[model samples]
Target: MDIKNKVIVITGGGRGLGRAMALELAAKGAQLALADMNREDLDTTIGLCMEQGVIARGYVANVAVEADVEQLFQDVVSDFGALHGLINNAGITRDGLFIKAKDGKVVGKMSLEQWNQVVDVNQTGTFLCTREAACQMIELGNEGCIINISSVSRSGNMGQTNYTATKAAVEAMAVTWAKELARYGIRAASIAPGYIGTEMVMSMKPEALEKIASGIPAKRLGKPEEIARTVSFILENDYVNGRCIEVDGALRI
Candidate 1:
């Protein structure tokens, strides 16, 4: 499970937590295949990883598409010659109440489009990427680790029906994959991150950010590197399988 020289694929590696993870793993001497829809962002991350003296490549793929996910793994293994780890970090959020009513009459509700978009990217994307990555690892006789990026909101956050459902499903999928893939020496796990100081989160109104920090017992937002470090820990510890590591600063939503 040593990360040094291991080849790892990180979906959504163009920015945010995915970028943080790519840097962390690169620092540990891991080869990286970073996938993202933004070619510019992907190139930026690739350059950063390369600066750390590790082999890094960028692939533009939509994790939600079956063909894209399949081709991503194939390309990674072809370039790196082996697949050692996969981090399913590609996800989207379209937060809305499942049902919204006013004065005893329905006003609005989460649209089918919102539900389907999040499900396709967060839940189905994880499934597709993991399946293809596992196939590559098994066929190549490599022991690998798969880490799904879940969320603290998986417990059912207000205004996040679609996101919450997909987050929960990915966590459950990790557990199932751990049990199912053990025979092939591939371990699966998940990390549930709280409100972190990513660019998107930090762009919220100052008051909103303060309110969120006040809710967490830690009295502050999490750093992206904190979750990145947790990823490294799971990949290094062979015994840590089928579990969701919460990096939520003791917050419960």
Candidate 2:
């Protein structure tokens, strides 16, 4: 689709990759409805996008909450009069082994708290947002697309049982949605990113971050803008659907 003037709703658009995509899309003439838990971050993003001469509004929300997700789409429709795209970018990590063992004894394990928290935000949250987006788009007879943010960890990271499951689910779901929602004139796709040089990842100890970078064929981390560019490509290309594109710098992991 021609990106200009399209109304796109991006969850977790306050910072990191979501913010980057919002800024990039805004620059290309898209009106944005950005949702995040942090009002300050949302305000920051809104300010940046507005400076680009685009219509940008910030909605404070938690994607995991069904009520919040419902309100978000309703507000987007009321504000923009149409919904064109949705980026399911809001996610969290609760990394831990499914079962931790010391010596010959199992002294620790992943808590249900950790499991539920990550699943709720990453899995359930994506489901909720996409469902609302589908309903809104179909009811309005709007042709739109959905992007789910997956992770390289979807392949199974050593210490990310909860996160891995959700990421894998994210990648698999786009195919299902694409097949199921094709009749509704909606396309679904996923982007699985490797370690990107984001604020949160860069905050990690240099040694650890470098160790990860060394594993990638690119010999460096990916940039948020790179992922943003992929989003743009997916939007502009009409035939790219029901697929999971890995933006992982050729990293096997």
Candidate 3:
């Protein structure tokens, strides 16, 4: 599981935790095939990785689409000649209460659209990407690793019924994949991160951020690099499989 010169594919590599992971792996000499929906962001991440003196390429892709995901893996192998790792980091959040009520009367409920949007990108996207990646690995006789980016909210969050459901599914999927794909020399695992200092999270009001940090035992937000490092650890450790690592700063919810 040596990372040097290994070809790794990272979905959602345009920004945030995915970008952090790309840089970390590049620093360790892993070749990168970065996929994202944003061309500009993808190019920026690629250039950053290239500056680390590793081979980095960018592809515009939507992971929820079967055709897009299949083509992504094919394109990566065509370019790198092998697939060694995949990070299912592409996800979106559509937060809403399952049932919003006022004065004992139902005011609103989670829309099918909200549920489908999150499920399609987070849960189904992970499934599609992992299936295609596993096929590539087995056919090429390459030992590989797949890491899904789950969330602390998988346990259930008040305003995130859709997001929570999908997060839980991705974690469960990694466990199932670990059991199913062992004979093929591929390992599957997941990482659930707490509130991290990503651009989106950091942009929240300072008072809101402080309240979040106060709730965690660590009394601070997790760094994107912390999760990125965990990804590298899992990929490099052959024995670490079928488990979800919580980088949540001791947060329960």
Candidate 4:
């Protein structure tokens, strides 16, 4: 469907790839409802979208919290009167090896706190937001799409047991939702991005990032805008569902 003037909600729409996707959709003339825990950064993104002459609003919301996510969707429907799409983009990482060892003994390990932190935001958080979005679409009897932001690490990444697990689960959720929600005219899909040159990744040491980029067949970090393009493609093509598109520069793991 044509996305112009359609009301779409985005989680983590404050910074990084989420910001890029918001601006990209704004450029396409879509109305946006953005939710983020960081109010200041969320305002910055909203300002940018307003500059693009698109209808935009931001909510101070924690995607991991069910009440916050519920209110987010409520506000979207209240203000916009309809929902057309949702991007589940809020995520966090607490990277650590499965076991941190010293002198042939385990000194530390991936704590339950660390694991739950990633899973809460990346896994349960996604599930909450997606459920709310799907509920809104189904209740209102509308056709829409849900996009989950996954990672190349979903296949399994060292030092990211928690993150990769959630990502892999996210893709699985998309497939399940696609099949289940298809009857409601709701499509589900995921985008697995490689090392994108976002603010977060760019904060790493240049040499560190260089080594990481060099591993990619593209010889460069993927751009946030590039991932945004895939969102546009998925949104327009109604038949594409239950799939994960890898915008990874051909980088595995």
Candidate 5:
């Protein structure tokens, strides 16, 4: 589908990969409904999109909240009249081993709080947003695309049981949605990024960063725009569906 003049909604569009995708889509003449909980960051993103000369609006939303997700879609439809695409990019991480470790030794079990928080935001949030977007697309009776932001860690990560599970579930939902929504002309796909050098990664210890980078075949981390480019590819390619494109520098985590 041509991105020009298309109405696209991106969850967690205030910063990181979400912000990058928003700018890229806006540059292509897409009308953007950028949603995030951080009002300041959302405003910054809006400014950047406006600099690209696109019509973009920012909405403060917590994707995990069903009411927020529902209202957000309604607001987008009200503003843009129709929704063409959705990028389920909002996610959070609470890293902890299922068996807690201290100094590489087993200490205790992971907290229920940690597990539930990650699952609530990453998995449930994606589901709610996708459901609302699908409803809107079906209502309009037009073909649309939905891209879920997954992670290479979905296969499993040492200290990311909750995070990995949530991402894995996202890919599963993507496949299921693709098959179910196909009749309605709505395609669903996912992008699993490897070690990307976003602010989240930058916050890691220097040695830890080096260790992770060494594992990647590319010998470096990925850029947010690389993921954004993949999103654009999925949006423009009508035949691609029910697949998770791994943008991981050939690294299997």
Candidate 6:
């Protein structure tokens, strides 16, 4: 589980937490396959890794597509000749109340489109990527780790019914994968973050941001590198498997 010179694939590595994790791993001498739908952002991440003297490449991919996930792993193995780990970090949020209310009266329900988009990318995408990673690890007979990015919202949250369900499902799947793949020397784990100061959170109303910060015992939002540090910790700690580590600042949300 030494990260030095290990081959790792990070989905949604274009920006935010994924990019931060990629940078941190690269600093540890890990080779990287950075996958994301945003080519420009992916290139930026690759540039940063290259500057650090790491072997890294970028691939544009939609994690929601099974074929894309399969092909991404294929391309990584073809280029790197081995696979060591994978980070499932691609996700999107389509927030809406399950039952929309206008003046305390039910007006409309969550749109089917919103629900489907969130589930497809957040849930199905994780499944596809994890399946592909597991297959590659087994085929190569290499010990590997898979980290799925989850959220504190998995417990439950207002205006996040779809997101909550998907996050919770993946955490359960992480445990199941650990049990099923332990004999093969593959490990599965998850990181559940709360109120991280990513672009998505930065764009929220100032008052809302302050309110969330107030709720967190830390009294401030988390940084992407904070989460990245935890990822590196998991990568180095071989005994940490099938567990979901919370990166929140004592925030139970």
Runs in model 2 deviating more than 4 A are none
| Residue runs of model 6 more than 4 Å from their true location after superposition | 102-105
RMSD, each candidate, Å?
A: 0.8, 0.9, 0.9, 1.0, 1.9, 1.3
Model 4 scores what on Cα lDDT? 0.93
Mind giving the per-residue lDDT tens digits that candidate 6 earns over 104-168?
Answer: 99998899999999999989999999898899989998899999999999999999999999999
lDDT of 1 at 148: 99
How accurate locally, in lDDT, is each candidate?
Answer: 0.96, 0.94, 0.96, 0.93, 0.93, 0.93
TM-scores, in order shown? 0.99, 0.98, 0.99, 0.98, 0.96, 0.97
The residue-by-residue lDDT of candidate 1 on 1-253, one tens digit each, is 9999999999999999999999999999999999999999999999999999999999999989999999889889889999999999999999888899999999999999999999999999999999999999999999999999999999988999999999999999999999999999999999999999999999999999999999999999999999999999999999999999999999973
Score residue 12 of candidate 2 by CA lDDT: 95
Positional deviation of residue 59's Cα in model 6 after best superposition, in angstroms: 0.7
* Candidate 2 structure, TM-score to reference: 0.98
State the local distance difference test value for candidate 6.
0.93
Instruction: Please report how far candidate 1 places residue 201 from its true position, in Å.
Output: 0.5
> Who is ahead in lDDT, 2 or 5?
2
Ranking of all candidate structures by their TM-score, best first: 1, 3, 2, 4, 6, 5
* Positional deviation of residue 135's Cα in model 4 after best superposition, in angstroms: 0.9
Backbone atom clashes (below 3 Å) for every candidate: 0, 0, 0, 0, 0, 0
